[model samples]
Target: MSQSAPYALPFHHHGKSKVRVGRVWREGNVHHMVEWNVNTMIDSDMEHAFIKGENTGMTATDTQKNTVYVVAQRMSQRCTVEQFAIALAQHFVRTYPLVSKAKIYVEQKPWARVQQGGLPHDHGYALQGTEVRTVYVTYDKAGKLDVTAGIKELSVLKTTQSGYEGFLRDQYTLLPEVNDRIMASTVTSTWKYTSQPPCYDAAFNAARGALLEGFLGPAKGGIYSPSVQFTLYDMAKILLDRVPQAESVFLNMPNLHFLPCAPVGSTFKNDVYVATSEPHGNIEAVVTRRTAAPHVSKL
Candidate 1:
């Protein structure tokens, strides 16, 4: 008979980091700026921390935050969110030998230059809407990369050319079907880039335009939609058609409700309605080419 001795398993694993960096590059008093909330995660194959209580190969989260700002400083001209995230992820894989993978996400808040005297101000700026621009990047030591860009909390509404019908009816079906109604949603969408584009900023702009166009364009609105599922498909399809570099597109639209209301005591009828944000319908779907494949294996 043989007895096996107890052995330690590797355990130093994940590192979570955040960076809030305000970048400004001035070109003769005309300044371009972006505020970013960057998050990075490092996944390693160190299991010794759990079994042996060792913390030697762990990378500090503070170090990751510093790396983000340092990389941004060097990239004043090419300071797109996607570019910064790629640089950050590459840094982790190259700098830390023990780290096997890095996932980086960057969110760029909307800020437009303030207008004064019928002109845009050079230094002054104002916070605009809730629409947020975001990027996610992943890098592996094995020479793999994945990049995704997205928009969040983009409130959209089309008064007409939207409806809900042709649904399964049952005892629980108290809601009535309508041929026309208000369509409102807080859109959250993400699209994975097949390959890194020449200019991430340009790609983002073009993709966003396609999404909005498909949602409310005259040509898109000309066709009738029976449900949000159809609209979601159209939105995603348009994005893929417009952005050739994109491999896939995803959309999550929560159907905000607008119940028709009429004055109780008066015989007057108004076109107004009560809008409800919660307890509403939800529709989500993803569109991609049948032959399209991920650049990197899932981590």
Candidate 2:
């Protein structure tokens, strides 16, 4: 908002690192993640006058652009997406006193670096999916602050293990039992930490590890699941229980259907149907509370 004049356009430049991705798979499942980085630049006078229209000393859009690039350059190598978010939030607010508010958002993309032998290549990588981590920050002149971060496009599955029972059945049911079959889903999982972690690597690693293990491992053979919904609850619990910094986990899973296939006469067989990834089941929960962890930061 520009305050110099009712029509004053206090200049601010914005840029975001869009559509970045990374992926790694362990034991037959593919894992992917994404992120987007953003920045904004506004000169002091322009900032001070956005609401007051006092654009006497506004920074030019060209300068703002240059500044964004400069900030990006300064931030690219050393900052985590969260730090970059914090920097972006702090930068414009301090730069412009007129700026009553500022916001920064980072969205992550899923991808995998091609492995040479058994490990990821030194520098080469590839995008996997549209899912991502989302981070948002906002600051107000009143000293109010907000920050949120989470993951995306977390797909998972296991063969002949998970189940979906206790739903209504109809007369069009020519379908067979689903007791032991492949359960597949392309999931979007997000968990927002209440605060920035002192150790970003540790928090990220723990979340990633728990997600992988939970998706791949069925906790108990028979006692673990009453249904898919229940299983999702368990998954959220595991994530909350295992990941320290996160205060909550949100999961969006698209049930990807595969042909119910079986072997016959020593050959592969297909149930013969097209698989789909839409009209997904949505699950959300608070996995942790800020009171539980001293290291957890406030939003």
Candidate 3:
């Protein structure tokens, strides 16, 4: 009888991560800039590297990091984060015959042009808080492609017009129901495209606008949010409606609690709150069109 292998190499993938790059393009006196943190991973048949320490088929993580900068340099001035991710994914799979599949993840820092008097400055920029635009793309040698775009650290809050009630009570329950309360969350959302959009920047903007509109309702009178779950569903639904190319939307909105506090020898009138980040509620869901096929996200 032939000797059998001691261990099975069931699955393996390797790449570089957190490769930060900043690219600037100049048009006369104006300049445009983008900063991205990128990560790359590739799936290939490299069992020998694990079993026998053969390194011929392995792609170095440093090489993967260089590839990100090289691809970014080749991109056009108008390139979006989604486009860069797709290009990087395609490059790995096409360049290396052993690479069967490649996945690229990118996060863009929000930087807006600063205003000089009342007009936008030509070359001055300011970081826009903590929010970021994110993109994930995967490509295979067989021409399979998947793309997802999203927003991260999108914080929103409303003082009133939100409440939580009618929860399942147990013997250990100590919370009380209220008709008015502060609602806040740091939203992290992702939406998978059915196909590549013509303009990724436009598609992202539209989806973000829909999410904000759905959450706040209108400028005059905001909509009442009965629960975080209800608001999450509505946000996803609105995004799908606004962007036809998006097949599905996934939202992760944690309830950042603002507990009401009363002053010394004073009655509580919902006037004060003790904001807390930890021990908060987590609410998330996926919304899709009725006819759209189900999507299995790798995020």
Candidate 4:
């Protein structure tokens, strides 16, 4: 009888530790800064490293760390996270013959331009809120490129134009329906562009603008969301409608509750609320247009 296959399929990927890099650029006192934590993976036919402990195909993680700094300095043109992502992916895929594909994920820390004396301050900046921008890029030997951009920890609240009702209220459901109530969510969204946009900066800005507009625009003139489920769909639809370059969008918005508590005796005001962060409702979905192909890759 034929011998059984030696183990299952071999492990196909290796290389690179997490590399964190910070870059600050100054052009005639106008300062721009970005802090990024990057992780890279190289996929190749390197089962030898796993099966026989032959590590010849491995690229040192230390070298990967050094490469981040070097690439950041060599960048002469204005560098956005998306642009830097492409640069990183291309460098790894082209430099290493053994690397059949490269995957790079970059997280950008938020820093806002400081405003002083009513005008934007030159050479001054402050760390903004925890809102972070993330980018992911994949490059393959066949020249296929996939890029995804996202926002995280973006807090938004609207006192009007949002409501919730018409839910299946069983005995366990204690929440009451409200026509007008405080709606708040920490918005986390990601969009995969149709290939790379002509202008990465423009596409990013437009997509972000669509999100804000969908959330904050007038109910009469814009989207009147009856619930977070409705609002999430509208947000994705607006982005896809407004930005032609984006092929698909994903959104995860957790419902932050501001439950109404009854006023105490005769002095406690009913307007005051206790904001609870944990044990909130998590809603997420992906919106995409009908594609000609049966399957589409995700980021």
Candidate 5:
């Protein structure tokens, strides 16, 4: 390695408009098709991780969009959002030479024109534990393709049913204690891909299942349970294990607290549930990969 190039690789930009159809509903008692459109524009920072003069082999826009079209065409019959993304990205690097890798990012806007009618021909609502999906793709000259997807903004809760205790105490630990308190949050979680082939629907189901089970599992009622930290780790680990594509999981939970009510008629204020958003605790832990190695393969 006598010398690396002194210049930088310029950006490679590509845009695509993709549409998908589904048997949205039996409108007027007859089966009809509904369409979802995803339009995306991608710009790769080609020089960011590269040696300057090596940029001659980088990919171009035509090739990138061709990959997008092929991916979406293949996914016209898919059943899960995550699955669609993974497949699209995988085909890109597997096809092009200049593209030893490519990044696939999509922006899906509502296409059911009926929103102007309050409710359209076929309509749906976003619900709790339901979220928008995103993915990052990576590939290397060694012929590795990684597809990582996640559902963000999924909501979860425990009704005085989840709690933690037995943490070692210290002199500065004047924290109030409650045997049973509410646990609720807008949860954000992510999982990286392993070597497994992408099964968007299967991985989606497993991640959701693991999130729910880990938070609500009977480990407390089971044996050798430690603390809330343990529960979080368990939830993350379970997700990685059950979803073969998942290599590791990272979780961030902000312990949502509701303020205690002040009783007007009675002289008691300790037990009522008056609510206020904080000024609260933020808990974060990485459930795997203690050492910082390349996460390139997992996207």
Candidate 6:
């Protein structure tokens, strides 16, 4: 039933995408919830499905979608998104002999417990802003596994103690140098772990805190940001110093501009500015220990 062709199938993977699920755990009156958008890809030896039009060994995409819900349901204990992703990935490789490897990507929406009269409500939750926690897990039949966790769309800003100056200028350069200006960015950070930490949530908190602290510095006098590039490096370095389990950290921070502006009758001052999102500077870097292997981001 097979026909030979000049082309060869060297790499093939198939699965489902955007399988959304919400899981909640309850302890007496207290409750916790996680809403994840999951995507799964399975690499398998199913060349026959392509070359010979065979469907016998192929796993349906619907089945893959159902597996995500099934795996989430089977998780009896509360677990981090990384743990859930790893479990779902391992399930495909172990359950299907044809599957050589499985990769899972999960994005968790931020939902903070609502406060009622200075106390957190037991079951009430409010949707936090655009920020989301993300994880990518890969598992192979040979036991090789990789996990990368990240934070996305985290918007931050500072009113002062930032500047850009003394850059190579050419005829095309029209921007002027300033000693003090507003710095803002929507940060996307990812860290790869050398080994699973005892508590993923704690590790995440440490990394996030480090990023914020590095950017804003102390309350008395904030740190001076020479440029976005300098701030990106500082944030990554701080994250590595705080997260021992993380072998490396990758940060993508776009320098969103807040242009100083004033009405025709009023003079321009630092207090008045116009916020802008597009036409921004893109800066990214990866910081890792010298001894650690070169870190690759799969997210």
Computed on alpha carbons, the lDDT of every model, listed in order, comes to: 0.82, 0.56, 0.90, 0.79, 0.56, 0.90
Location of the lowest summed lDDT over 10 successive residues in candidate 4: 290-299
Q: Over the stretch 128-179, how does candidate 2's per-residue lDDT look in tens digits?
A: 7554655666766676666566566666666556666556779986555555
Query: Mind giving the per-residue lDDT tens digits that candidate 1 earns over 216-275?
Result: 767554555667888888888888888889988888889998888776865424377898
Model 6 residue 213 lDDT? 88
Between prediction 1 and prediction 2, the one with superior TM-score is 1
**What TM-scores do the predictions have?**
0.90, 0.64, 0.96, 0.90, 0.62, 0.96
lDDT of 2 at 291: 55
* lDDT of each residue in 1-299, candidate 6, tens digit only: 33465677788899898899999999889998889999999999888898778887777889999999999988889999999999999999999989999999899999889999999999999999888899989999999999889999998899999999999899999999999999999999899999988999999999889999889998889999999999898998889899988888888899999999996899997788988999999988888877876566655
Clashing pairs in 3: none
What's the lDDT of the predicted structure labeled candidate 6?
A: 0.90
lDDT per residue (tens digit) for residues 129-191 in model 5: 245454555555465666565555556666556556766689989666666666666566767
Model 1 has an lDDT value of: 0.82
How high is the lDDT of residue 250 in model 6? 86
RMSD to true structure for each model, in Å: 3.4, 8.2, 1.6, 2.9, 6.9, 1.6
What is the TM-score of candidate 1?
0.90
Q: Is candidate 2 or candidate 3 better by TM-score?
A: 3
Question: Across residues 1-299, which tens digit of lDDT does each residue of candidate 3 receive?
Answer: 12484767689999998999998888889889999999999998887787778889788899999999999999867689998898899999999989999989899999999998899888899999888999989999999999989998999988988988999999999989988999999999999999888999999999999989878889887999999999999999899988999998988899999999998999789899999999999988788888776565444
Candidate 1: deviation at residue 218, Å? 2.0
Instruction: Output candidate 4 Cα RMSD.
Output: 2.9
Candidate 2 segments whose C-alpha is farther than 4 A from its true place: 1-67, 109-131, 142-145, 170-177, 218-226, 261-274, 278-299
Residue 98, model 6, lDDT: 91
